[model samples]
Target chain A: MSFLAQSAAANPWFSWAYLRTNADTIRALVVEHLSFTVEAVAAAVVIGVPLAVLAYWVRPLSGPILASAGVLYTIPSLALFAFIAPFLGTGRLTVLIGLVLYALLLIIRSTLTGLSQVPPDVREAASAMGYGRLARLLRVELPLALPGLVTGVRLATVSTVALVTVGVLVGKGGLGQLIIGGFRNNFYKAEIATGAVLCVALAVLLDLLLAGFGRLVTPWRRERA
Target chain B: MNSFNQMINWLNDPLNWTNPDGIVTRLLEHLRLSFGAVLLACLVAWPIGIALGRRGRGGGLVVVLSNATQAIPVVALLTILPLTALGFGARPVIVALAVFAVPPLLATAYTGMREVDPDVRDAARGMGLSRWQLLRGVELPLAVPYLAAGLRTATVQVIATAALAALVNGGGLGMIVSAGFGIGIAAGGGQILAGGLLIAGLALLAEALLAWVQRRVTPAARQT
Candidate 1:
């Protein structure tokens, strides 16, 4: 008749003894983790790509933008989480801001490198065909830059997956809740191993998936240096 | 303004500084752990990197291993390592940080050596340079800048991550930060702000110092 007993009865995975405080809530936690990774990486790409292009074109702003991102990237996961928690009050927003900041430098740097790595002749030819700056950037340069862009995405996603565990400190990071739970319970193997193993497994799965996706999108990356 | 004042207030408190568990001691412990990890990582990664580069055969392996290791979140590693005989304190955290630090270091060293000019290598061989001599006289020197740069990146990363040591009795500014957060966000804001400021300042300082070292060790002639 009680809510706790009812939920425990309903869900086979739910147990009162060990993961009582939502510890073994594996399904919801995993979903939260995935969304955290996806949302953060998506935002980074959306914001970072345009900023990178603007930096490239504007020239004067490039150094500062890249430098600031680099500095932001150096802030530790937990430290950043703590700083943001007070402001955002935890949950997805804090995680999102932390991950976006972390990924920005990599995304911007790679986009710049990937665009620059394309031989000048390719651009000249595109221009000769009357491709405007915007068209050439999208059609010619962007495709060629796909390899680096994909690589950035791959790194960001994997790192973000790992970092989401830190969110446990604030009660919002996906796998982290289980991890901290285990830690507090004196390294209960089921809780600790399940959380750690699951987190590592998820990160690797995402990384491989992204790598495969990268190869599919940028076939030229494999064919060349 | 209030929070900022509180931070200064917390920081200014002499009581916060007097204990063995004070920020000063914690900072020292953090430095020791971070530097130990980076040094250990360099010892392991650079040699392996050099060997792989010499044979021109292991960049793929580095990428795979790095990605795999990177995927393991530091928090998980921090918690799990203690479950093993690694015990607690700094050993496991040091190992974990080193594992995390190895990627950039190995990747850069391998790439640096591999990217050396083919013509330069051939000329060295033609000049009858011995294998060891060629490595020392040419390849190793060429890789120094790249190695330094990699070390800088890895070191900065390691220093920042070292803060997490506080989570598991491994003392650092993280002790202050985590304690603050644990005390509840609003009430603990001062401690968190003070700790956060110190860690951020330390990270930036490490970046600048290492960048200087990277710039200096890179031979002037390698500027091109």
Candidate 2:
């Protein structure tokens, strides 16, 4: 056999047959990553949106809070994971906490930006119409800011998906297992191909989903198009 | 005299510098990895980013791609790449870092190009400039500020994520952290804390440098 064939034969992970045979495994991996991503992102939105609203209302704390989030963003994922592991222990919970923390900066920034983008005059007019604080927020400010908030969600979604892979390191679920296992076993082709496929597919799917959502939520953007 | 002597003793500690696996060495390695990744990413991403930006037809698509790429967990990517390539080292780490770097560069470049004032483009076209000339002379110059901002974001991200390279045994400041955590800090908590601070300082320095470069390169006209 030729050297290429020899190399391919030697590497189980790289074989087309291996990937084909492991279809069920790959699906499970993808599902786990997706579920974890969704969960973390949802948690982040829950925590982040309120903080964003409070920060926006308060104004003074926004800068500091956002800055601190920015600092958190700078902390490396592995290091963050390691740091939090001491307090949270290993597994999905630790990964979730880290992902949630990571998501906060982007979500908060976008939330603030979205809310602030609503014209002051529009807000004043809403108040003149006797809209209560909650009413004005839900009916006017939120709807106006929905596009940006959605953008933030879109960002958080992609980030969480990507981050869930990191969950593999802490003995949680996802494609990270495939990656880590493949590496430890010296399976180069399987490792590279698996990573490449997942990254590309996840990226494409997320873009399509977010674009669709953006269109649905922001008819004005569509009209402009 | 006793207080002065205590202060002097603190300054002379071996932990301050001379250890072979010192914080300074680890910090340098992390910075080196981050810089290597960013440079590689720029080399790969910039041309593509510029092309996509100039095209302007699929700006949203590019943004989505970048955002998605950015979102992928670093550990996951690191884990997979090395496995495919067989065994772990700096190459896989660099590849992971580069992959992470691409989205921001491409998105920002695309956005910058798209956000260029239509009037400016029209004026350039009106002056009988060809498409290539219009892109080089009018569109690109206008898009630089936004592009710089995007690069600034990418720079910090690359620096931060490069720390993950340690998980794969790629060796960087993360080694200090992971090793410290593995052994428990009582054995070397000082080393780990020092490494963490070093990483933080390097990140700050990178942010400052990139910001400075952005400010310096950006035209005075764009400053407002």
Candidate 3:
């Protein structure tokens, strides 16, 4: 029943020691946290990328589709999770679906922006080279748009990782389980801080990993810079 | 379909509005928490953003840093912060919401200010305008749309995240939501839906208001 700050106020000396004793448990929680993040981001990309392409290919559909996605994004995460529990039974499925939906608007917006902003002259040159629409999009537009796509995925990855803790409401919380445990223990500061710190670290690590991938794919951009 | 009917019944119930934990009070509380967070976020983030935008040194670092911050889940923050000296209450809720709120707002202000036409800035400088005068007469006006857009984004996000306050000791529309699920299946489902819908409605309304403000500010931002 140790509440972190309250006890920290009393005995700040042993916080690290507390974390040390729980190292193995923290490691396991981090692994679980990563898995939840990956699955959700993967699901978001599967749905979001194609939707982005569709919005690009069909100009008329873009506004409404993007608007709908924006509206969906505005729904608070806790409410959205609770909203679905009736159907999904408060498991990982409910949280995963919410994560996927939350990721879509950011992914689609980035994808559309990246794809659309490909220089018109470059597109014209592609056509002059006798490249058809699909071919031009696949080769020219897609590669040129890599920065935006990379940015989108990077943001989504971190967001998904952060949100994995929220799944505790449904008993699928990864690092969030610790936070819930902390509360149940009457504000066990060390427990909650450990979970929160790990969550932040996971987010940073995932973002850096994706940024590396972005760099690997867009090596030419570095030369330009 | 059956659940929808039940949700409607729950909405129709008089006590849902008349009780101390009624929709009206909760909505007001939600607005207050959201407003408090956004105000604090703007105060903290905007000046630093404007300063950084003037210098243009930290864009790359901030973009990466913000990505990292954005990923820290609201639930974790709510719970963990309570364990801090800030203990559970409206204060911790505002702190968490504002922390998350800062990124988008700061980014928008910085970008907006940065994107003002270089020639416009040069001309103002040529006029022997002091830095303050130039910022007021030139950059700030040109940066309106960008800053407004950022404000909108931050406000919407703060409002949305504020719903998580219910998980802590704070009260808002989330009370209905978290309480519903805690209560059970039938009654809880209906209450959750009502609460969820109300929160969603508030988000959309705030977004629309901000979007209009962004558009309204455009006269000051003459396109180069």
Cα lDDT computed for each candidate against the true fold: 0.84, 0.74, 0.83
Best by TM-score: 3
DockQ of each: 0.58, 0.28, 0.62
What candidate 1 gets wrong by more than 4 Å, as runs, is A1-24, A215-225, B112-142
Worst 10 residues of 3 chain B by lDDT: B215-224
Inter-residue clash pairs, candidate 3: A2-A188, A3-A187, A3-A188, A3-A189, A4-A189, A5-B83
Q: Is candidate 1 or candidate 3 better by TM-score?
A: 3
What tier of docking accuracy does candidate 3 attain?
medium
Question: Could you give me the TM-score of model 2 versus the true structure?
Answer: 0.76
Better of 1 and 3 by DockQ: 3
Please write out the lDDT profile of model 2 over residues A62-172, one tens digit for every residue. Answer: 988898998888776766775665445566788888889999888999998999999999999999999999999989998888888898988777666666666654667
Per-residue lDDT of model 3, residues B105-194, tens digit only: 889888987898889989999999999999999999878888888899989888888887887748988888877878875657888778
lDDT of 1 by residue, B10-72 (tens): 899988876788888878888999989999999999989988988899778988887688788
User: TM-score of each candidate?
Assistant: 0.87, 0.76, 0.88
Instruction: For candidate 3, give the lDDT of residue B20.
Output: 93
DockQ order of candidates, best first? 3, 1, 2
Give the clashing pairs for model 1. none
Query: Which scores greater on lDDT, model 1 or model 3?
Result: 1
Return the TM-score for candidate 3, rounded to 2 decimals.
0.88
